[model samples]
Target: MPASAFDDLDSYIALPRVEALALSPDGRRAVLTVAALRKDATGYERSLWEVPADGSGGPRRLTRSAKGEAGAAFTAGGDVLFVSARPDGDDAPEAGQLWLLPAAGGEARPVTRLAGGVSSLAAVAEASASVIVSADLLPAATTLEDEAVLRKKRKDKKVSAILHDAYPVRHWDHDLGPADPHLLALDLSALDDTIAAAVADEAAEDAEATMDASTPYPSSLPRPRDLTPAPRRSADVEGAALTPDGATLFAGMRRSLPRGSRSILVAIDVASGERAVLFDEDGVDFGEPVVSHDGQTLAFVRRDRGSAERPFDAAVWVCALDGSGARRVAADWDRWPTQLVFDADDTALIATADQDGRGPVFRLPLDGAPVLQLTDDHYAYSHVGVDRARGGYVALRSSWVESPHPVRIDADGAVTPLATPAPVPSTTAKLTEVETEASDGTRIRGWLVLPEGADAATPAPLLLWIHGGPFASWNAWSWRWAPLLAAARGYAVLLPDPGLSTGYGLEFVARGWNAWGREPYTDLMAIADAVVARDDIDADKTAAMGGSFGGYMANWVAGHTDRFRAIVTHASLWALDQFGPTTDDSEFWSRIFTAEGMASHSPHHSVAEIRTPMLVIHGDKDYRVPIGEGLRLWSELAEHHADDDGRLPHRFLYFPDENHWILSPQHTVIWYQTVFAFLDEHVHGREFVRPELLG
Candidate 1:
């Protein structure tokens, strides 16, 4: 494919991608979720695909449904188990439910028919047939049938009300409750045996039912027992892994604290309803638990809450199964560990961390040795599946230049491609790494994408794109804020990692902690100045854009300087005090920020100083930086410029159904088109072009 082909937003969104890889027990086969455009090209649909662990043949599609299949896992017998919303021909609920595909390659059939439907899946290591599923339950309903009846009653009454006692009534993009996520365990050993015998009996009675059937034969499915009993309000368990013996389950559980909520590792007895906190420490958060194959050792990531002087630091900690001898591993490693997994023999750990300019995989030894850096590339890896039997691992690798695909990495640090669903469009621009020194002499770095025709004589307009997460880095590929799309439009895109970005050590992050307008703001300006000085960049045509925390910075930049021609802030925080009290996870932020700090740093407090045209974009369902922020920002901009005689050009783009991100394919196209039009009008002195779809 020519690089120009992907220059179109439609073609870019149509690219086939894969994520969520799960390797089988014997390391002979793996399954992953592949997302492709639906038939009408309106949106993407995800389906499960299987590939060989030996990296021989291409991936084969396993399940196809309108609802799509995800959260894939392999059972002990090598059968594939996944969650889907596909309706059974009969009376199945409309939510996601567990389905099983036989190991020998047959029809995928429903494994569990719960009322709330399965949200995620986990299998017992020692007993592969045993599985645990998470589902939503009404506040008082105890059983699946009761929950189903309650849902029906609510539907019949057309009621949509929720009662909450907590400070937060919603999450990133959704309401927190009427129902809460609950975990249930299903011992499928007896059901599997019964189904096998029933199938044999059916074959003898009716040959047609045993052959070419699209669904599994009707058999009695077992009732899953509730592991998280009632009375445990507001308890959330996720990332659960069963022990090798299947006697205990270790998972990350979030419990309420005085200030907020903190995640801790909990060990639950598989048979009894007893649970114990395995690792708990004050001023710390623990999660992502991985147990060794022998079930003797546990490895998890521990994050130390930041102090007034330091930022948050994450490190891998290892402890015995009995919750003793807990010690930090690779204490000197500067990078924060994520997506951790234990090797088969339990001697070492494989994990991914944001490092420098990329998210790289690292192998950390349990004996406190230096961490080994594996896979030296610009791409980032996630949903890693290890094949200890084959002495290798498979992960979904992605980069700014390409979408994610499944790749295999061997012990010798060799990366082999496993599946290629679609061709990556050739780029119309080249990516280069650029660095500059902050005001404090601290080194700052970022990626610069220069357009195809950009040069000394024909300079391109620059877009200073700031990443979200004041805590995250722009090290991975993002379909939402793609740089290639901007490059194709004859723009040089600058993705800078300022203060509070990961990959950099805690000290670097500390520079911006509690002080949003200090180092991070200066560092961004320093990098922008460096980019503008380049001969290939048109400094006068530069514009600034950001989302979330980046959005907050954009607002800050607008209030502090008139350097940029225009500014775009999406889902930004306008008033720190209002945002802190109303955001979905209020507790978490309240614990980290003080009222005085909020008032001092909030951009809304200094709105009168703004002197630049702006485009404000927000989604109504964005609970993280909620729609209120955008409303307040727009109001402030309007009220401050009421006497400006309409000289300042400002527009507001709103999404009613969308959340923090503009995810709909059609909506995303409009988003980019509108942004380009706004930039052209303000920065290039071109006429404003309204999006046709919006009209």
Candidate 2:
């Protein structure tokens, strides 16, 4: 048997990871973006690999550079288009630039050299070589040349400030920006002509052998046409698709309001650069646009804004390209679809949604028939790309037992995994399902991971792992919070999806909507009670831990009960009234929570009741849950529990440079180290051994 990666943090972090998949138009090949830990072990670098869609051959590396590449899309000619910050000649782009890997198989060449490098491939025409990419452009610049000059001036003057006239000045981790994103269109023929001229000039010089990296491509390339000009701050393109002929583009554009913004679908003429609103309504936002094979129909997701009384609802909607004949798909279905793509036959649409603790693929017909599930498994599927010609699909599937990898799904729901360089890591832990009934008679279920020798004779310590999102499920695998690591330390971890978790019907979410401390709290306690009753779990030795909304629940659990020996909260919501207006997006938070509801559920009111030791972790750069929350939490803990000598049983781990999540490689290792140490001290009655790096 193979060794479990959880045995060693270094070995676990060194494992190769795969993300994102792009299938060719003919469904012959797939390009996967795989990230491997760098040689220095400071970060991970991504590379493109070609995998045979038929599963006949092994994966082959396509591109290699220090800067790495991602966001791959296939053009009509089978060429792979990706964005990378790799150097061309002596100049390294400040941002990622669009690069093309030719179908004929030579060397990847740069396509666009803009002041703000291309960010992502927006849309690719099926019948034409034209492509659209999203890039950031200064609002003051009218042309690409003008933008270049303005950027140079700013760099020379060392001006790092941005004047915002909008509601949200910052997002989750970073500032919103000095430049807004715009969609740019490029004609491949013009680029081809320019490349031909450069090659001819090099031949005329008769210096092919001497053609170093400095002069491989021409200095003057055809500039891309800016499809969106003067978009200001409202140009956040959420999703986009192009017509078969590349003559029209349908995109979800964010419309800025006095306090916030809402997304609306728009159609832009490819040639004339004219845009018209295709769908816009009050109190609703639309995104994830997809066009059919024939380009006559459009599909997108419509989200009805939520209120204090009820949570928001998302529905699949389809209409013509001209914005007529709009109707909801599968109106009777309770599942909320997250992805949409037209199948080969175009008679039905293929989509994916969370269901029964897993996100499975489904086929919904245009005639409003019953929705049919395409995949029946324990894995959650994402990045679904439909095979237009063969009526098949390619996607990335993952579960609690395995990491994400590329797979091909047939029309009959058969799945064949494509070759990947990363092999699934083994673990000594075992997974099993546990369910119980809440006080309200609602069924609550979760996954329990047990260490290798756990039994009635030697019951393992328990860890109640509450998932964040309060709206997310515990179906998918997560590197950040892998339960196997705890199992490797002879601990059992329980992952419970309580109320407000998706996949469950809307009614289940509503049970905890206005009353966060009610159903969600009771559901978690109910599931934990059932698990602790098992002979293989130690009922007296347990702890509760969570982050974000989960963190809120952990605090609530601490104040309401004394069952758990310890608690861990990360980026938590300590005070409802202070948090509502201080978060990154106040409008969305305020709309969903009323003053009365917040007061009734606020965890800060119970601070005086908390008796369990706690570990509070937060990032200073986290704008979503500001650092003030952690500071307030630490202060309250001291004021309530500290002795005359100012000593308390609580600890606060702060990261000044990290965002909401600990992203750096070293920092992530420290995060796990501190968490394990804290748990050992409180739950296992072991001495509190502080991590060496913290000192």
Winning candidate number (TM-score): 2
TM-scores of the models, in the order given? 0.94, 0.95
Candidate 1 stretches with Cα past 4 Å from truth are: 1-3, 122-127, 192-219, 231-235, 307-309, 643-648
Maximum-lDDT candidate:
2
Candidate 2 ranges beyond 4 A from true positions = 193-196, 199-222
The 0-to-1 C-alpha lDDT of every candidate, in the order given, reads 0.82, 0.87
Candidate 2 per-residue lDDT, tens place, 7-118, comes to: 8777778888888899998898989999899998889899999998887799899999999999998999999999999986554447788898999889998888786788
User: How does residue 289 of candidate 2 score in lDDT?
Assistant: 88
How well does model 1 score by local distance difference test? Answer: 0.82
